[model samples]
Target: MQIYKVGGCVRDRLLGRPVKDKDWVVVGSTADEMLAQGFRPVGKDFPVFLHPKTHEEYALARTERKTAPGYHGFEIHASPEVTLEEDLARRDLTINAMAEDDDGNVIDPFDGQTDLHNKTLRHVSNAFVEDPVRVLRMARFAARFGFQVADETKLLIHQMIANGELEHLVAERVWQELEKALLSNQPSLFFICLREVGALKTLFPEIDRLFGVPQHSQWHPEVDAGVHVMLVLDQAARLTDDLAVRFAVVCHDLGKGTTPADILPGHKGHEQRSIALTHALCERLRVPREISSLALKVAEFHTHCHLLFELSSCEVLNVIEGLDAFRKPQRLSQYLLACEADFRGRPGYENADMPEKAAFQACFDAASKVSAAAFVNEGLKGPAIASAMADQRCRIIEQMLKPFRKNTGGTAS
Candidate 1:
């Protein structure tokens, strides 16, 4: 029997990052044998045990079955005779396929170390198509490691996409990996990779519609909504890696595809439509209500409120006063960041070196000074009698005041 370190924990260690979790693969081991040794058996579909002392994960060297499709379809085979090489072969990417023996001798059958040195992501075997999740995983790794997928690996992914292998991935798994990719350091590459593989169409078909859609030639010299979105994503990667902020980048212009252009001319309420679309998309992905709701508000109001930043303080205050429904100070900060990214992505010489950074800094300072609770407690009673607020009157008022009441003694917009 051989116990060895495998996957990201090992990969990250080689890269000199703090190893968050360490997983061990026990070759030539069975569940019963592990249990006999007093390890706690845990994995439902596969043989996994918790080390009695360290309590770290110890998964048995097992083969898998393609019961259906996607990540969850795999049926595991845990046998005492399973080889470490066999387990590594089933992995999606070479970087993750590397393992380390007890004495720290690295195993590199697929030349994972060489690829790591080259900063390239390549599949371990052609069995890459066996699991549709590999495509998303590959994109995520690209974002995480700043590695370009090798030509052969990219070809395999494209082949899988053309063959409809990626269609087997469920929405939940797609969102999970997509979210990870979005929150990574190079999220734009992930979407670019998806676009290359033709899997973006299979995953978020809505995004596919943005491809050829035209934009205002004068304002958007970039020419199309897809290009604009890609630029915004690139802008996001250059900025923070916050999930909420990145979600805003991915979703801010979703309504553009549906806005009636010619008749309305520039299409009023595109921001509102964007929010509605964001909510529906978040719902489909089954994201948390708190995060999704906040993201929706940011998308819905970003374009509208951003224009107001150039207005007088009176106008800005009026807008902020109307924003009583928004309680989170970070909400506006996130919106400003999204707007700055969007604005910078917008094509125009005048748009460059705009006051957005100063605007965001001002808003952040204001939020630090004023708490949401103070705003709510400023002699405002429960629920506005207005029809628009009837649904959210109580909750909205409560959130508005939360920042106001805190002992920190501050007001924030």
Candidate 2:
């Protein structure tokens, strides 16, 4: 049996990226023969083994046929006769279909190397349409590598959408791909690619509806709620690598889609609507509580966070307490980051500073320092202690923000 290094490792290496994992394809090998060696069986549906030493995956060279629908509807055929080329042909993208031998010889049967050189993402074969997940995967790859999808590949994706292939994709699989795309270097491309292939409306209708929605030109020169969201997502990526923050930013403006047309570009009371929409979307996707919780908080209070400098000390303290900033300071910081991204996402505001963030953080720092033990030591009990804590926290915020309020000539409103 001849073993060859294949898939992402080879692709990454060719692109001068640090290889994180390695997968091997064993050509001319049977399951019995693999077991006779030291490889441990691990694959549930097909022939995959674990190397006894390195513990890396070693899947047998195999070919598959589409049977029913979705990604799971595949019939696998693996035997000693299966060629490495045949196995490569079943891959999604041409750039990922290339393999490498032990002697450092590169195999490019589908012109993966040529496509790589051209910075293009092309499909491997006509079989690419068989799996609906490939549409998401290719979009994710576009986000990760910043590569343009070939015309033919785009055509195939459109065809897949027309044939109702995307409808078969499971929610978990969709979330999995979406989470990965959000963490990519260019997360906006993921949504852009999905929109191009008409899958965004199917999978993320809430986000899709934002495309034509208008926003106040004074606050959002970009105007379109969808464009604003994409910009916010990109800015969130720039600020932090936290997936929770990025996801919150992505859903922060969902309420804008539901704005009343008679109100034109104004989006009054969108915050509560955004909170409801975020909850519904999170529930549908089975998103983790930590992510959904942060998202909900940001959706509800992002406007509060933005207007912190203009609000009263009591208002600032109320916002901070509502976010549970004292107990979970990290969540507050994440919320601020998302808010900052939103502030700077609009046209001509990309490089603008967020003084409100720093001011709010300072207020939080001062209030968080208020000793609960001090209040309890004053013979205060239960409800009395809670009132004393709120009073002290508000006083602390007032003291810290006094100078800024005076400078702006603004009263506690």
Candidate 3:
């Protein structure tokens, strides 16, 4: 039986990145043969196993058929006769189609190594049209690998979208891929590409409306909602690595277009209104509730950072306290990073540089070591704690002393 290292592990090794996992493609080996070699069978519809010794995945050579629409319609056939070439041919992208022998001889029948070297993402075969999920995967990979899709591949994707092939994808899968894409270093590229190919409108009609929507030119010289979103996404990548925070970056300020005026003139509670809109958007995208909740909280309160310059130490702690009452105080750092990124995305709000960012981080560091006794010892407890904790005195005090609840009350003014 010939066993070869395949897909991402090998690709990452070639790219000098840490290989997260090892996967194998086995040719000339049956499922029974794999089990005989002490591998645990795992694949339900195909022949895939986990090696008993190394606990690495070993998938037997298999072919697939599209019995219906969407990604789940695949019918697979596993056999000992399937060749490495045949298996690689069915792959989505050239960069992911490479394989290597036991001695490390690269098997690249599709010139995937060249594409990898050139940083180009291209489909391996015309069979790419068989699955609608490939478009989303392309967008995500473009963001992940920081590479552009090949022209021919882009053409195929456009054709698929035109034919409504993407409608076959379920909401969960769409959100899953969208989540990864948004978490990438340049999530805007994916959204921009999706818009260009018309998939953005088809999949997310609400966001599709965001493209041509106008913002106040004085504050948002970026002009259009889409560009503003892209700018925020770029800054979001620089802000934090937290997925929920990044989700806020992608979704915050989404309500701007819904206003009657060209500029959201005389708008009140825009932040709170946007939070509600973000929740609906996240739900429509099928994002998990916990993540959606974080996004909404961050979006709702992001504007409060404007008061950070005017805040007292106790006031700062109070703001922190109020935030902590809703979620983990540790997440405040993430929220702050999201705010910093959002501010940077705007025309004149790029003032928070490394020093400013570090100052905010220092507050988080200090909060982490702070305890209830520290508050009392500092004579900062009870009525001395500031009037913002009027109704939440005990709750706020408990949270202040509690290491995990640093942001529970005291900063409304």
Candidate 4:
């Protein structure tokens, strides 16, 4: 059997990027032949094996046919007769269809190298629309490499959306792609790509609806709610690599999209609306419990964090308790970051100083210092102990934030 390196490892190498994993396409091979050669059987739907020593995946050259719908609607055929070019043609993108021989010879029958040189993301063949997941993969690749999708490919994506291909995507697959895109340096492009192709409305309508919505100009120089949110998502990526924090930033403002049109730019009481929408989106996407919970809290209390200086100590304590910060201090830190992203996301406000971030951090730090052990040792029991601890925590936080609260008056928004 002859094997050639293929897919991401080849594309990344050509772009001078550090290759993380290697995938090989083996031609003139059968499943039995791979097993006899000490490779471990791993692929469920196709003939894929693991190298005996390196344990890297080596999939036999196979071509797939669409059987029904969704990503799993595929009929795989792997045989000795399956040519490397045919296998490559079945890939999602032109840049990912190239292969490399062991002797360092590059194969480019699909002109993938040319697309790479042009910084373009083009489909390998018309068969690209067979799998709905390619739409997300294309957007994710754009986020990763900052490559523009070819006009023809973009048209194909629009067709996929029109023909209901995107509606078949499972929640798990959508989350997987979204999580990867969020990790990229410019993840905003991923959402923008989906929006441009109308796939956002099909897969993530809550986010898609945010595009034409307006926000208060005084607070958001970027008046479009969707634009403001994309800026926040990118800013969160810049500030921290924490997926929870970044995801929180992505969902923190969903309520603004659903605001009453009569309210126009003023999104009064949008926080509660955002909280409900965040829960629905998380539930629909089957997001992990930790991630969903953090996102929910950020959506609910982000306003509290942004308005920390204006809140009384009791209100600040309420915010802390609402976020469950005393139990998971990480939530407090993460919530602060999400709120900071919102403040910095507006146009001309990218580097503006947000005192509320520092003030909120200080409050949580003070609350952390107050111990339940102190109240328990004082003979308080059950709910009494909790009440005493809350009181002490509030006093500590209040003492720390006296100067800011004094300067900024009024109740929490």
Can you write out model 4's per-residue Cα lDDT over 183-278, one digit (the tens) per residue? 999899999988877788888888998998877656674568899999999889889999999999899889888878555332346877888999
Candidate 1 overall lDDT versus native: 0.72
Instruction: Report the number of clashing residue pairs per model.
Output: 18, 0, 9, 0
- Please provide, for model 3 over 116-221, each residue's C-alpha lDDT reduced to its tens digit, 9 standing for 90 to 100: 8999989998889889878888888877788877889878888887777888888888888988888787888888777766788887665677778777765576
Cα distance off (Å), candidate 3, residue 174: 2.2
lDDT string, candidate 1, 1-413, tens digits: 88999999889988887899999999887778898999998857778899999999999998887787667877888898889999998898888998998788999788888888999888888889888888888888877887888889878878888878877777788778988888777687787777776777877766766777787655565658877887887676676666777787788788777776652212447766777778888877887666676577667556544454333334344444443434555666666677677777765632475454455445434433443454365555445323223323333433443443343343333
Per-model lDDT: 0.72, 0.89, 0.73, 0.88
- Estimate TM-scores for all models: 0.79, 0.95, 0.80, 0.95
Give the per-residue lDDT of model 2 (tens digit) for 1-413: 99999999999999999999999999999988888889899958989999989999999999999999987899999998999999999999999998999998999999999999998989999999999999899989989998888989889888888899989998899899999999998799999988987789888989999998887756685568999999999999999999999999999989888867555332346777788999999998999999999999888888877667578899888778778888999988999999999998888888899888888899999888887798788888988988988898888998888887777675677
Which residues of candidate 1, in runs, are more than 4 Å off?
260-266, 309-326, 346-413
After superposing all C-alphas onto the true structure, candidate 4 shows an RMSD in angstroms of: 1.9
